[model samples]
Target: MIAQDIVIRPIITEKSMQDITKKKYVFEVAKKATKIDVARAVEELFKGAKVQKVNTVHVRGRLKRQGRFEGYTRSWKKAYVQLTADSKPIEFFEGMM
Candidate 1:
């Protein structure tokens, strides 16, 4: 998959924000994308950044119920990308903080 297609969007949450200080960023990724694919995608999408490691999690959709109806949320994948020490931090996330 293309770099842009492999990485869906950045995951901005309280827990994720805490990881930013450690040079680790989280992102929502395509279900079929591998760890290598996510690492390359982050490097390409964010200039001046180099990925040192990538961790992925498959989050299963949780079931929800309303009255008598029941359904499950959409399942998706998440990627935690850690950048090399010497590489610049992602500017997009910096601006957010």
Candidate 2:
């Protein structure tokens, strides 16, 4: 898959935001994307940012109910990308911090 197709979107949460300071960014990735795919995608999408490592997590769907209707949310994959110490930070998140 292409770089843009592998990386779905950035995950913006309190935990994810804190990790940015350490050069670790979080992204919601395609279900079939592997660690290597995530690493490559991040590197390609953000120039000057070198990816050091990538960790992936499979989040299980959770059950929810509303007025006698119950269903589970869709399962998704999360990727944690760590950048090299000397690499530049992702500009997209720079203004957010």
Among all windows of 10 consecutive residues in model 1, the one with the lowest summed lDDT is: 37-46
Tens digits of per-residue lDDT, candidate 1, 30-95, equal 999999999988889899999999999999999999999999999999999999999999999998
Cα lDDT computed for each candidate against the true fold: 0.94, 0.94
Runs of candidate 2 exceeding 4 Å displacement: none
Q: Estimate each model's TM-score.
A: 0.96, 0.98
Model 2 residue pairs with clashes: none
Clash tally, candidates in order: 0, 0
- Per-residue lDDT tens digits for candidate 2, residues 1-97, read 9999999999999989998899999999999998988898899999999999998999999999999999999999999999999999999998898
Q: Tell me, by TM-score, which candidate is best.
A: 2
